[model samples]
Target: MAGLSSRSAVAIHALAMLANRREGSLTSAEIADSLESNPVMVRRVLGRLRDADLVWSTEGRGGGWSLARPPRNITLYDAYVAVEEGRIFSRHTRPPSGACEVGRNIGDLLDAEFQSAERALEERLDRTTVADLLQRILAADKEPADH
Candidate 1:
């Protein structure tokens, strides 16, 4: 099975960062730094997020990215859907030979399984929000005293 793209990861990370700084905004460069990525890459993903209405941006001085809605209102599924479009699992490009019983049935069976899995994934993701993720992230991090 093919895995989801890193664009989803970037969008989630950026969303959490924005949630953590709900009072302000973060430039694309700031987000890219956290991901060890480039500003353009961050911008591209953020642009998709913007289209989804999960985030908004500004221009000129102090220009940056900010959440369009409250963090609690933005589920991980929202971010996932914004960046990752279409199916994560793909069926065969061409239909299998109908002469073989196994080949004839496998495609439909696998597609049903894939659709079920995708639904499960979406359900799980829809349960968490950016605020939820940030809380978990902070709780899981090492404190200065531990360092």
Candidate 2:
């Protein structure tokens, strides 16, 4: 299964939290508390998001972080790309040994397949905005308990 990097997930969570509480900015410490993680890690992820223009940070005691734009304008794909270091999926080494005919071509074939899959994932993510995600989460929270 393809799993999101923790940094990517943390960044998204932090931005979504800010979107939900748009009245004011939130410190990395406040975000870390809600995420059950360390403030340093939160700051690191926030730094990446800031570089991506997905979020903005301010300095000083009262300063904190906030989304650069409305949540509806941001997509999960945006968050994913912000923290991705390299190819989403990468081969550890050249695929099979060159001794066999199939071995030499396998890597190319696999690379094409990986690229296609990544494109599809990006398309799907583009259709989903942070606003959509937050709405779904809030809806689930409001569901009546089964007694």
Candidate 3:
């Protein structure tokens, strides 16, 4: 039932912003302001990104966060794996009753299907980079020209 959580989305947004502003670092408060989110939440998401080596942080004066590598090198799949809680699709909370023939076979039968779907999703994610996302954002924000 659970899919990519808000943390994953926030991670992507934060990374995109960081990628766009490659010249300097940004505090979690500043990043959160850009995202219209809580600074604490931004810090938490950025912390996860930091742990994954997607972003790095500096403490104290002029301190903030910055992408560890170029945006083009960071795939969306990396962020997804960094913040998402579990698989794209999840099994039922309770194990199916093995006493029933259908229950006994359902997990095994659906596992391959779920795995295939996850692979498809990950493939799409792997194709999208933070640089690509920032480019799209920049393009969308551009003012239309008058003819």
Candidate 4:
């Protein structure tokens, strides 16, 4: 189904990194290093975030990226919406066969179902802010490992 893209993951990761290091700006290379990804990919994701005003950047030496607002103000859904290009669920590439009874009815039914599912996912994401996620991440990192 070609479900979701990795953009959301990258965006969320970058946001959490920024939240963790709130006092200073991070270069794309630095963020990328933590992600084990390249600077180009990090910059691409950051560009969308910048467009949404979730983060900002500056030019020249010693300048890079920083969050535009406090972590508490930015929700996961905000990052999702900023970077994702379309609905989480996709529809058929072409019209289903109108002559067939199942095909005729399936398109509308599937669309309604997919939209509902997408909305539910969005609502769940909206409940957690960057601050909340950072807290959970920190707590999780402190957990003892089982042998």
Candidate 5:
């Protein structure tokens, strides 16, 4: 099945890290280190977050990124919309040739399905905040030793 863009996942992970921090911001390098991902890729995702106003960047020696607001104020849907470019699934870019009846009807049918699915997805995401995910992450981190 098709899935959310990896950028959405990275945005969530990066936001969770920020939410977990008690003080100070994390540079792109630090976030990249945590994700074990390329720093450039992390920066790009962070840039998108910044553009969306979900994150704010600081300048200078100790400069880095931080949430624009409290984690609880930011829902997963916010991040998803910011990074997903407003589309859950890719759509037909070019019109189908006037050749087949199925081709004429398929796009509309699939588009309706996609819209319904996207709405449900957004509704669920709206109920989940960055703080909620951070809590889950923290709990998971503590679970191994408890087991």
Candidate 6:
């Protein structure tokens, strides 16, 4: 099945790390290190978060990012939408010269269906806050060692 963009996942992961840190601020390099990705990618995601007002960055030496508000106020939907530029699902071009009735309307029909599904997905995400995600991550980290 189709999935959320990798950028969405990466943004959430970065936010969760910030939420977990008692220090409340982390440099982009540190976030990149934890994500095992490049600092530029982390900064790009952070730039979007900053635009969304979900995160704030400091300048100069010891500069870093911090959540703009409490985790309980941010939803997964917020993080996802902040980075997504186009429609969640894109429609391919029309089929060759409307060869068949089905081909003619298929894109429109699929687009409608996708929009409906996306609405439901967004509603579910709205019910879950970043705080909930952080709790899950923390619980997983605390799981007992397996033999």
Write down the TM-score of every candidate.
0.92, 0.90, 0.88, 0.95, 0.87, 0.90
- Residue 30, model 5, lDDT: 95
Q: Which residue pairs collide, candidate 1?
A: none
Q: Could you give the C-alpha RMSD of every candidate to the true structure, in order shown? A: 2.1, 2.2, 2.6, 1.2, 2.5, 2.2
In candidate 3, stretches whose alpha carbon ends up further than 4 angstroms from where it belongs are 98-101, 143-147
Clashes of 2: 0
C-alpha lDDT score of every prediction, in listed order: 0.92, 0.86, 0.91, 0.93, 0.90, 0.87
lDDT of each residue in 1-147, candidate 5, tens digit only: 355769988999999999998899999999999999999999999998999999999999999999999999999989988887656675677777659897778888898999999899999999999999999988888787756
lDDT of 4 by residue, 66-94 (tens): 99999999999999999998777877888
**Clashing residue pairs in candidate 3 (N, C-alpha, C atoms within 3 angstroms):** none
lDDT of 6 by residue, 105-129 (tens): 7887997998998899889888888
Query: What clash count goes with each model?
Result: 0, 0, 0, 0, 0, 0
For 44-67, candidate 3 gives per-residue lDDT tens digits of 999999999999999999999999
RMSD (CA, Å), candidate 1 to true, equals 2.1
Lowest summed-lDDT stretch of 10 residues in model 6? Answer: 88-97
How do the residues 65-90 of candidate 1 rate in per-residue lDDT, one tens digit apiece?
99999999999999999998679999
Candidate that beats the other on lDDT, 3 or 4, i.e. the better one: 4
Error (Å) of candidate 6 at residue 99 is 3.0
Better of 1 and 2 by TM-score: 1
Which candidate leads in TM-score? 4
Report the C-alpha displacement of residue 56, candidate 1, in angstroms.
0.7
Candidate 3 is scored at a TM of 0.88
- Model 2: per-residue Cα lDDT at residue 10: 94
